[model samples]
Target: MYEFVTGPLAWIAFGIFIIGMTVKVISVIRLASKKDKVVFNHWSWGWSFRSVYRWLIPFGSRSMREKPVLTIVFFVFHVCLLAVPIFLLGHNILWDERWGITWWSFSETSADYLTLLLMAAAIVLILRRIVLPEVRIVTTAYDYLLLAIAVAPFVTGYFAYHQWFDYKTVLIIHILCGEIMLIAIPFTKLSHMILFFFTRAHIGSEMGERRGAKTW
Candidate 1:
């Protein structure tokens, strides 16, 4: 089980992730090609190249600065989502051992804290969906499921690493859940992980150039 999960499944998941992202990128480019040039701001095609960097900062634009709660939620969730997994000491160690590649790692204690903050953010978003009337109207099962898929790996991983449950079983569950997330990214609404860049960049460029607004 260990060998299969760590070896074959890992490779399979990586392949799927790469292929899926490539396909999604192609789809976006094709869709963009069909869009009328008049629809975008007067700026050159490279506008997003500059404007995206600005809006990427939390509350960087006049529109977003007014909604600090939303900005905090958006910023914190993405940060912890990427940071916790990439910087976890355990993951870096495994990478070095498996592929002979090594990178900096965060202290395990820091990773743990970040993971907790991530889970908390997930809960807050979930509760908002349930409680807010306008949001609840638009929310769907797919949304909640996506949240669960995103959270499952770290949820199981934390338990396994902390030995809060059956260690062997929880560890297997953690590996399985992480692989599942990787495989599902392109196929699910989780595709937003990649799409967020395209959509946000387009919006930022349009607003910044057309309205003479600075996201920064």
Candidate 2:
């Protein structure tokens, strides 16, 4: 009976995930095709690529003078948060056992540390948005809600890992939060994720045009 329940639910979740991702990707591609071509200046493209490279390296220099502490905290949080689940041994074990995919894992200690860092980052980001006038003025209610939605799964999963509450309940909450975020991804400002590159290129192109440069 338990197997029957979990089996069908798993299939349903898998179907939703696959279909939703396909739709979102197709929409983004269509939108991009319809939009004006965005050109980038040599320096702007160089900086964008450099930022990605810096993110991969342990500590590459990048200026964050405008919001130094907040920028550092945000980057640290994203790095640790992303690294944890993808590299964790327990997650790999589940994948291998359930789906026959084998992958490497990081240490449990590292996962725990990353989880703590991610939670701290979420809190700090929320506080920064509230306390800083510039951040607050620009933030919509949806922005705050989206942040909460994005962070809830990680936070719940951390507690679930520690068995801080009933294991089943916490696990269910974690999964539900993840599913909610998945559903919300293509509909909200979270969609900026799909549009970010184009938006950056468009801005860069406009700036170059203003400066009377042939390149964006």
User: What lDDT score belongs to each candidate, Candidate 1 first?
Assistant: 0.83, 0.67
Give the per-residue lDDT digits (tens) of candidate 1, residues 1-216: 977898999999999999999999998778776884644535444566666666677777666788788678878888998888888899899889899988899998888888888888988899989999998999999999989999999899889879987898898889999999999999998888888778766765676667766545
Off by over 4 Å in 1: 35-46, 208-216
Clashing pairs in 2: 40-216, 41-216
- Name the 10 consecutive residues with the lowest summed lDDT in model 1: 36-45
Error of 2 at 200 (Å): 2.9
- For TM-score, the strongest prediction is 1
Q: In lDDT terms, how accurate is model 1?
A: 0.83
TM-score of structure candidate 1: 0.90
Off by over 4 Å in 2: 1-22, 35-63, 204-216
